[model samples]
Target: MSDWGPVFVAVVLFILLTPGLLVQIPGKGRFIEFGNFQTSGASILVHSIIYFALMCIFLLAIGIHMYIGSYFFLNATVTPLASSSKSSENHFRQALLTFSNSKPTNTSFLSLTQIGKETTPSDRRGCCGVVFVEKWLLQRQDWRGQKMADWAPVLIGVVLFVLLQPGLLFQLPGHNRQLEFGSMKTNGKAIAIHTLIFFAIYAILILALHVHIYTG
Candidate 1:
């Protein structure tokens, strides 16, 4: 698989995890509704799932980028690039030194760096883990109010959530209510915890995958 295969999965995960896809604004008692049929609680659980999944997917992506960058760094030292030529060695050394002096910073508390970019590097790889993070989190620190284009991930997330809906149905067993899934009641706190656990499981799964790839 390519490096981005995992990323694609992560993106899908982000999209699926987008809250309010099936149920918008649960706080207002407005769940999934179509015509005279309506359903509740199912969307809350789904929204929770989405929130947690997004957190997990991004965390996993960060780890993968770091691991891949580390692999690249280790490979650079012993591979032909660094070992075969004095010029390459000098480049690697300079890159390393520069990286040491200007380490990357976390770009956003909500996320690591942007999905698929590294901000800076001493060599062509630049510092795989640092650049985007540095640029996003550190240099351009006003992350709370980014431009609309910058919110592409979030917007894409919403679209993905809508696309993942199983289908509209009127078979649910409530009075004039139809549901997307098994009926279940939830509150903000419960939904929050569910999302957290969802992301936690996802993070572990990706870490396992990362280990397999790294060792493979």
Candidate 2:
């Protein structure tokens, strides 16, 4: 799994480095060229920064999902002592009482009470003896607001990813490697490759983010 992580990262990087895809902002009426096209030094720097920032965000999200998914998966498999014990007690009592009475009415009472007791509010409320009642109570207090709150993080992430330019993290490798606008040398081929990589990554992340925000 760990080996796969780095391999996946390399593949993503390679896709991002491929040349020649252009995107146009519909409302702005401007073309953002990708993949081996002639472009100004300033334009190259801005695009590079944007791509880098989006890549970092996508990596961070992947890390977070992995961590949270593991936690939930482990937690779900374990049973709590309190609930298990309570269930056994109810069953045993019902069995003993049913045999003792031997009447249909008494048998029905035992069955109803036993099942009801097992599933009562207090018994079914915790996760592996870890009490979630307080959390549940708190959520109820602002349930509507809490439901809508899910969109906030997704919205903010989308806004940041779109607004920021790619490749902000570092200068494009094999290029001039300079910090300033004039110092960097813009190779048409390299720029095109980088641009293509950026757009591909951008499209994938956006699709993933959309699925997450909507499905979650």
Q: Please give, for residues 20-128, the per-residue lDDT of candidate 1 as tens digits.
A: 3333434335444322222244553566466545634554334333323211111122111322345444544564454434422222221111123322233234222
lDDT per prediction? Answer: 0.35, 0.35
How many steric clashes does model 1 contain?
9
RMSD of each: 14.5, 14.6
Candidate 2, residues 39-81, lDDT tens digits: the string is 3434534544554555455544543222111111111122323
